[model samples]
Each structure stands twice: as structure tokens, then as C-alpha cells.
Target: MITKGRVTATLDGDFVVFMIGFRLNKIWAIHKWLPVFLAMPKMLKELNSNKDLGYLHHEIWFGRTLILVQYWRSKEKLLAYAKNKDAQHLPAWKAFNQSIGSEGSVGIWHETYQATRGTYENIYVNMPSFGLGKAGKLQFVGKGQNNAQQRFEKNE
Candidate 1:
């Protein structure tokens, strides 16, 4: 059994939050889609095992389109992982380019947010751990911390 309640989260210092995922433009093209799907676990496994790479953690959403929200210690660290030749990401990326060159069988995208302390605020009420909640430190909301603005002030 699970209980639901209020839980808030905020991170410390400068950090990078990355949102990346893909969409299946053509549901019938399993060959094209499966490789893209297969590539993620390899990269995620590599990141999860090596914390120094600044891969903090992630939450994923799956559907016709998939989304992954990832936190990192810094932008430099995140870029390093993306560019490192020895890593799983680089190979998988090259394969993606080769196999699916914008033919529209699949679509992929990403957005990155570079943040510093006090730049973001979040709240989770009657919910499980999620988003910045999973990526940041969790704390119970208290007096004057019941809404968005207060959460920013309380977290700061």
C-alpha cells in the first residue's frame, strides 16, 4: 500500500537539467524504432554507474513519444558525456545518424536548462517522488511554504 502527502524538493548550487527523448513518427517501422529505444538503456546504465560524470538521476515517460528528464552537476560534465568517444552515447548517436537521417520515421529532441541555486522551485502534493523531487533534496513543506513563491524562499 502507498500513502500520498506533500513533499517538496530543491537542489543546491549551479546545475544542468536536460530533457531529451524521441517520438515514433511511423508506428509500423519497428526496425527503425527499436534501435532508438535500445540505445537509451545502454547510455543510462553507463551514466547511472558513474556519478563523477555528473549524471545525477532521471525520470522517464513512455508512449508514442518518450521523454527523459535528467539532472547533472554542471553543463560541462553533461557535454563531456555526450562527446566522449569511449562512452556508449557517442556510438549510439553515430548509429542513430546513420540509421535514421531525418527521414521522418522517427523524431528526436532535447532541451537543456542551466540553473543556479534559487533559480527554480517545485512542489509535490499527494504524489510520489517525481521531476525535481527525484533530482533534488526532499523536505517537508512548513509554514509560509504552501505555495510556489514561498517554496522558492524556503528552499533558498
Candidate 2:
């Protein structure tokens, strides 16, 4: 079963926590069908392949929009993957940048959190869901009590 996992920020409140959000608009009209046809298989392969390298969690929404919520051991790992030359991600990114750089056909945006206090999360199993799925199944530990309240509470 493909499951989402809780990702907490652990940078002693220094490194920024990113809620990266992005939508990819297909130009090839024919590519409009790629998500259901080709992308799913590619995504499954990537997810399964990188399951061990601190790949915390992810989800696809609105067909073409992919929202990846991952917890990195550190920001360095995240940057490494973003800048990796050999990984499939880099090629995809480059292609997107080249093909849709001017018109915003493909857009990527991110929100960062400098967690001075703390962050908590949960995961939902056996369901097709997004970031909210993380809030469904979670157990809190010492100083990490009140998972519900924590998840619902607004970030500062």
C-alpha cells in the first residue's frame, strides 16, 4: 500500500520549512492525457526507487498538479536532489523550464516556514488524498502532544 508519512522540521528552528506547491500545464495537447497514462507509472517508479533516501511523503492532485510534502534529513539533501545532474528530476525540471519558462504554462511556487517552535504531522492510509492525508493517522510523543490541535492550529 502507498502511504503518506508525517514530516517534522528539525533544524533547531533555523532552516526554512518549505510547503512546496506546483502545477504543470501541458502544452502538447496530447500530453494532456499523460498524467493518467504515462506520469503515474513514472511517478510510481520514482517513489518506489527513492523510498529509502529520506523520501518522507508526496501526493498528486487535480491530475497535473503535484504537491510533494517531504521531510528531509536536512535542507542540504533537498538542495542536492534539486541540483542533481543525473537524476530524472533535473531533466524534468530543465524541460519544464525550457518549454514553459515565459508563459507560466508550467508553474512552481513554494512557501517556507522558519519553525522556531515546532511542527507535527499525520498520515492517511488506503485513501486518495493530498497534504490533508498526513493529518489523518498520527501518534504524538513527548512534547509533541495534541496532534489534532497542532495540525489545526495556524502557523505563525
Candidate 3:
């Protein structure tokens, strides 16, 4: 359901923010890019099916360049998932390297951030729980939590 008022999100401890995506460089090379594109859903399905994998939640946007923002319980869990041989990620990664291999047909990249209390803050107004809000606890923005600086101070 949609939350009608100002709200904020808080996590108990440290968390991980993983941003991963791909850019379709050569649109005509569907053969080279489509496999790369199709691989993500399989991995996402695997992660979603198993909560213990450390995958909390994810938001995806599609276009010429696709962006996926993923929240993880911890950095160790994220790295472990990436390297897990029995998981979908490892096989898909191997396929990407064998097929695409920096040919410029498809450009894939990722950025990982480690966040802790006092290091990150967020506010949502008249919107449904999203992003960090979905990954963490949602609380109505209180008297001292009306602004970014206040949120930071409160979190600190």
C-alpha cells in the first residue's frame, strides 16, 4: 500500500548497496547482448527464492541502459553469492565472459557501497515504501526528522 505522509527508513546495522547494469552498445547484436540480458532474471529468481543468500530486495529499470539497485544484508553475503559455484551468478558470469568479453556490444558494470548508521539517510513523502525503505524499517518522519541534515543527525 501507498504511505500517505512523510516517512524514513532505518536499518539495524550495516548494509550493502549494489548497483549493477548493462548498456546496449550495439543494438543490432542481439545475439551477443540478449544472453547477457536474460541472465539477470535467472540470478534474481535464485536470490529471491532464497532469502539466506543475503539478497534483501532489488529495483530494476530498463532502457538502452538497464540499472538494477540491490540491497543486501551484508557485504560478505553479497560477495559469497557472486562466487558461489552452485548459484546462478557464477555460471552466468562465465557465460558473459565467454560470449561478450568486452566486445563493446554490451557494457556491464557494477558499484558496491557499504553503509552504516550515521552514514546514510533517506526520506519519502506521500509515496510507497521503496529502495532503502523496503530493505529496512519504515517510520513516519518525526519532528526532528523533517530534513536531510536532521535525518543524518538523528541517525548518527
Candidate 4:
């Protein structure tokens, strides 16, 4: 099991954060939606096994839409992985285009964020490790780091 804490995450410098997920527009169409849902786990497995891919870690939330929060070592690494033919992403993306192009039976989307040291702040009180805390490191949220405002002021 993982330990819980009020610690803040620590990182060397700027890192690329990617939010990627898929939605099932036509939930009844198992043929259309199943492949979309199944493809990610295979891609995730490949990424998890290869450290050079820059996939640090992920947290998933499932509903009508599935959300995956991904942390990468850098933007370049993420792009390289996405474009590499030998890698899982490119093939998946190509297949997605070929199989589900504009049909809207299944939908996929992603958002990206860039974060740097002292530019962002997070606080977790009486909660398990999560988000930035889970993806990066967590420092002790002590006397000076008790609240978000204090954390930002002191951390920056």
C-alpha cells in the first residue's frame, strides 16, 4: 500500500503533462467502442515497460468517458513516442483514423500542460497520494507550507 501525507511534490524543472482519454458516443455499439477501449491498455503496457518513452506514471478515472492523467519527462520525449512507428502510439493513432474517422461512434481527445519548479503548487491534507503528488515527489507540508497560498509563496 502507499503512504498518505501532506507532502508537496518535488521536481527538477519543467515537465510535460498530458491528459489523454476517450469517450464512447455510441455506447450501444460494442463493435465500435470495444476496440477503442481495449487499445489503450495495450499501449499503456508498452509504455510502462519502456522507461525511455518518458511515461512517468498515470492515474485513471472511468465513467462514460475514461480519463488518463499522464506525466512525461519532457515534451520532446512525448512527441517522439507519439510519432515513432515502432512505438504503440502511432499505430494506434493510425488505426483510430482508419477505423473511426469522423464517424463519431467513439471519440478521443487529449490536453497538455507544462509545469516547472516554483511555478505550480499543490496541497494534500488527510488524503492519499494523488495527481502531482503521485506523479512527482511530495515534500513535507510543514509550518510554512500549511496552505496553498503559503505553499506558493514559500515554494516560489
lDDT of each: 0.87, 0.47, 0.93, 0.83
Q: Residue 97 in candidate 2 has what lDDT?
A: 61
The sequence of per-residue lDDT tens digits that candidate 3 reaches over residues 30-147 is 9999999999999999999999999999999999999999999999999999999999998988999988897789999999999988999998989888999999999999999988
Rank order by lDDT, top first? Answer: 3, 1, 4, 2
TM-score of each model, in listed order:
0.93, 0.52, 0.97, 0.91
Expressed as tens digits, the lDDT of each residue in 1-156 for candidate 4 is 355666777666778889999898998988988878888899889989998888888889998899999988899988898889897787778888999989999889999888776677877766677777777887777788777787777756
Window of ten residues with lowest summed lDDT in model 1: 1-10
Clashing pairs in 4: 8-138, 8-139, 9-137
Candidate 2 segments exceeding 4 Å error = 1-18, 24-44, 63-66, 112-137, 140-156
- lDDT (10s digit) by residue, model 2, range 1-156: 443443322222223344655565554644433332343355446645884443445544554665555444446555676677765566665665665566655557666443333354343444344343342223323353336465434222
TM-score (C-alpha, index-matched) for candidate 1: 0.93
Q: What's every prediction's RMSD, in angstroms?
A: 1.5, 6.7, 0.8, 1.6
Cα lDDT, model 4, residue 45: 99
lDDT of 1 by residue, 1-156 (tens): 212677787787788989999999999999998999999999999999989899988999999999999999999999999999999998888888999987889999999999876677777877777777777877787788888888777656
Order the candidates by TM-score, highest first: 3, 1, 4, 2
| 17: Cα error in model 3, Å | 0.3
